[model samples]
Target: MKINIQNYESYCLLYIDNELSAAERREFELFMQENSALVNEFNALQQTVLTPETLLFEDKAILYRYDEMEASLPSSFKQSLYREEAKVVDGYFTRTRIIGIASIAAILLLLLGYQFYFSNSINVKNDKENRQTNNKSLKLKSSKDSNNLVRVDANNNLENNTLTKHKSEIAKANGSKLFTSNNLPSLKETDIISQEIKTQDIIIENDVVTNTISSEVTNNLVSDKNAISINNNNSPILNNTNIPSETTENYNTINTDEHDRSIYIANFEIDGDKLRGVTRRINALFKRNKNDKQK
Candidate 1:
């Protein structure tokens, strides 16, 4: 049979108190023999219950003497003793309170210092970031100004080149013109043939001149198509094609128009492809439907 731990503890207490019957004692000894671990626990309990009293006053006369001496002590002395004890207790509590307050103050100071340090670090980081952002903005602005200056220079160069080309073409056309002299010969067949050939050559030259003039007119038309008037404080009004405009407003407008046209063309092509895809899908669906109907 299994014995409960609580019943064993009760039995051990009863045995220590000498309240167990002989039969119970014999049964307990047999149980202890089966569980040898209980023998040490039983000895420990017995020792605890049978502790020897070393603080007993064996002499009655000494005890009476102590009692008389305590009675003979003055009442003021007893009151002073109690007062000293209260003072000691109060001092101990005061020191403890002081230490607790100091600890709390130190902890608060540490927390404040940490918060100050963290805030300072964040502020420093923000300042640095602001400075960096300002520097980057300045650099970007400078770069943009430089790029504008370079663009202006490039425009001036292009205008100068176009002007030189126009001047050279006009010069070449003037040089190609035939200069006539007032001289005549007696009428003859050779002279007539020569005159015919000269006439044919002059006609050809006139045709060439007309073609060059047409080409020059076409160029002027293209340039005038997107002409822009510039209002510069330092430049005078320029109405002649021999001198091109100093401003890039016309060039910029032409580039913008070209870019917009390119974008429109791309979009148109994309829409056309989408329409073709839709048509193909519709055709495939119709073919499938026809096949299904035939089936």
Candidate 2:
């Protein structure tokens, strides 16, 4: 069994007081004899406990003076101490508040900077997209203009062919030798068409002859060549003296007398009384239809 060194002092004190039994005293003496160092330490401890140094009492009042001196301390001294402590605490709190505010400001600044950077990047991206779109639009417009030019050239060729056919038909109808190889010099189709169009414009500007001559010529030219016809419903119709009898019969057969009558009536001048009569007849017809529906 291992003996605890902490209990050695207690064993020695018990042995000196003769409180241990013979078996315990014999075991303690055997333990001390085996540990010679513990025996010397125990003897010194026993001497110190049994004969301690004498304590002098020259200043016995010093022990009881501490409480009274503390009680007699001035209130101002305590207030000053408390004030100093409070100042230290207040400084610590102020420094903490300053740090917190600085951190918050820095965070806010970072957020604002990020937002500005994001907005700028977005605007730049939008600008790039806009530029790309504008470039595409320009390319499309250029392509469209080229296509239009090709279409215009094709249309001009078709118009020249139609004009040549018109010129031949007009020459035959008028029984004139206008396009004869000997009489007129050979001209380009464009030049001939342009000259004809100019002549027609001049004739149109002359109001006195336009209603009679221009309408007949334009109608004959359009009908014979199957060209685009003038849609002027108000144009006056003249007697087709130069037109072939077969052509005249075809025109008359295709259009009914009722159609001619309607055209003539549309062109005819009407008085206010006739217009009022027409309105009254229309109102009576509407009223009759409404009554029939109800029945």
lDDT agreement with native, every candidate: 0.43, 0.45
Put down candidate 1 lDDT per residue, 1-295, tens digits, no spaces: 2334547767777778888888887777777788787778888888887566688678876546565556666888877777433443455557546755665565565456545645655665555434433332232222222212111122333343443344334323434211111111123444334433444343344334434554343233223323211323212222221332222121111132232232122123223344345446655655675687699
Model 1: residues with Cα > 4 Å off, grouped in runs: 1-93, 147-295
Clash totals for all candidate models = 0, 0
Supply candidate 1's per-residue lDDT for 255: 35
For candidate 2, give the lDDT of residue 86: 38
Question: Candidate 2, TM-score vs. the true structure?
Answer: 0.21
Candidate 2 collision pairs:
none
